[model samples]
Target: MPNARSVVVFDAFGTLFDVHSAVARNAASIGPASVHLSEIWRAKQLEYTWTLSLMGRYEPFWRLTERALDQALARSPEVDPVVRDTLLTSYRALDAYPEVPGTLARLKARGARTAILSNGDEAMLADAVASAGIGGAFDAVLSVDRVRVFKTDPRTYALVEQEFGCGREDVLFVSSNRWDVAGAVAFGFEAAWVNRAGVPDEYADLAAAMVVGTLDAIR
Candidate 1:
């Protein structure tokens, strides 16, 4: 639970936005492999981030996204190269989850300061927020690009305190990705795991402060 002064920081991809919707939007062109492509693309994107961070190397998340898509396309050769451009373009404006706008509004109406702390690059976050028409909802959109790394890294999580001058306990970090919520918990933030899929929890030692089915359930 967040206190009145707690800044509600959301993870962008799976929490606020429906990342799989990019492939769903172009399903007609992707054919039966659409689901596999989305799964592989997302998995590889995160893998690349961790791999790069371990190697003390960095690539902008946008580049990792493209590289991951290429890998997914290669694995699903049934998907035509022609739809590649369409899929990539759709990622820039991926659909927001139905409750996002109203939830953000309610939080703001209650005087909570909201923000997004994402692995997405600045430009990617800007485009997605603009496309969702929720560009003004956040007080800050902190990207890992600022630190040249990705989440699970303490430096990435540190951006919250850096931005708001708040202690870890003064933040409620929300993410649909359990690993992200675990990372926030490890960093000492009051974390909420938005378990939209009703999946069993992992990272038992670093459990979230709360778990909810959706953003609307926060508070």
Candidate 2:
């Protein structure tokens, strides 16, 4: 396996940015009691992604986000329409995780190239990077729009290798999602699970090369 010298391709949502905050903001629009709605919605969204991935029926992340949000709202009658729309707007501008800047800086200082490989469309990612004031933090920002499939698919994972012009083993795939870490490992990339929630044992069978509480740990 290639070491840290290899390019690091990170998953955007949950790994580098906070998608939950956006969901919460939107859920609040419907009703005052929707505090935990965003979290539940996020979990369901990820579950849907995994389910679709296994079923071989792939859809764009944006579509999934909208679908997940709609379903989540359907279950809760108090969500307001105006608030929901505003929350959707907030999603396009999610703040970066607190550790993202320092961790990314450390990697860059070490001469390690960094990039984002996400299910987010290029437009959404561009806005997010700009909003987070870290557009330059990444060497490349990859998207799944070209392939129309989510992560774990060979086409989506292959972008890292293609962009950096490196072999699969020469890239270190980092993600907060266990399925993503597993997929990277399966694809021959040195995988690291950013166990931000301390869920190392949850994905233990995937054999992630490394597990860390923060990106700084890996850097």
Candidate 3:
């Protein structure tokens, strides 16, 4: 892993925020199987992100997520419009995982420079950070909108190094997604896979600096 003095950059959605919780909160109105619906909604949302990236047809994350949700809902028309609105409203205030505040505090206390590199828009991310009550925890919050590209793209990862005013080697990047871990490594940042789901076997060749179960485990 990079040295402790190096800046640490994080992926916003899965790394810091409990995006699943937001979905779970709204899933009930969308269908009878609320949890399952939320799972499918998340899967489709990510699928659309990667698909759009590969197709070189980029859209904002909010619009893309809404489109993916609509498609997922079509498979289950029994889903209630009220539930959909509930979930959509919930997006405006996603909860951070329980470990987040303490972990961020630890990093900040150590004088580590921290930033969020997310697929979300600046406005959306700003609100998320503010509502989470951790807006002051980060040195900066970067969005893909600035580069018009998503994670796994070299340009997206470059933002981390740029914002920290450091070389890629001077940053410690953390991500829960395997592809994102690989991309950050490829971009020359020392990367860590916060494999909270225990799915690291697929990324054996990616040479991450560390593999921890959660943000709290990071040193």
Candidate 4:
């Protein structure tokens, strides 16, 4: 029997998939530049999203990601046209964290419905999920595209309640991103923080229900 709160909603990207996998996978071409590229690329990508959102300028996450990549590798001597294409291609098939499939399966066996509420566009989510071989694991994959907004938007978080027809408290919203955890909690969901990097809780005031290091510790 499932608990009263039987729905688990995950934040995709860095939570389930390693956002740096593409760079690491193409390391031969990218060289030692992968480390700096990953950090700057991720930061710039997120900054672009928020910047666009604040300006009411809407663009697909894919577009923002490509632009961020251009900026990240713009001055790097290591990246060539071919390496750039390879890194972009690798992004389509990101590596899933080792425990993701098992954790999802365990939740499913317990009669819980699992889903992904991601800032990723539908196409990106589909490609990554399919590549990770965890496509069938989710009952639904909710992309911000449907609402046409990024996370931290109340509308994005509302998708979970909308899909499950349950109150916020009945959906255990899990995210590895601190901002995302705070956003879900602020939106009234029973949010949990997957502090996988062992960082201190920056949003401790958000009152998250759980502050564990991984999805497997969601309870």
Candidates, ranked, lDDT: 1, 4, 3, 2
Q: In model 1, what is the error at residue 80, expressed in angstroms? A: 0.9
lDDT of each: 0.92, 0.80, 0.81, 0.86
Cα deviation at 103, candidate 3, in Å, is: 1.1
Off by over 4 Å in 4: 1-4
- Residue-pair clashes per prediction, in order, are 0, 4, 2, 0
Kindly indicate the candidate among 3 and 4 with the higher TM-score: 4
lDDT of 3: 0.81
**Against the true structure, whose lDDT is highest?**
1
RMSD of 2: 2.5
- Model 3 residue pairs with clashes: 29-83, 30-79
lDDT of 4 by residue, 105-202 (tens): 88888898899999999999999999999999999999998888788989999998888898887898888888998999899888777888898768
Better of 1 and 2 by lDDT: 1
- Any residue pairs clashing in model 4, and if so which? none
**Clashing residue pairs for model 2:** 29-83, 30-78, 30-79, 30-80
lDDT of 3 by residue, 1-219 (tens): 445745888898888887788766654444466766677778888888888889999899999778777776776666764566677778878888889889889998888888999999887898889989999999999999888878788999888767767887678888888788888888888888888888634656667888888898766
User: Least accurate stretch of 10 residues (summed lDDT) in model 2?
Assistant: 24-33
2 versus 4: better TM-score goes to: 4
Full-model lDDT, candidate 2: 0.80
Instruction: Kindly indicate the candidate among 1 and 4 with the higher lDDT.
Output: 1
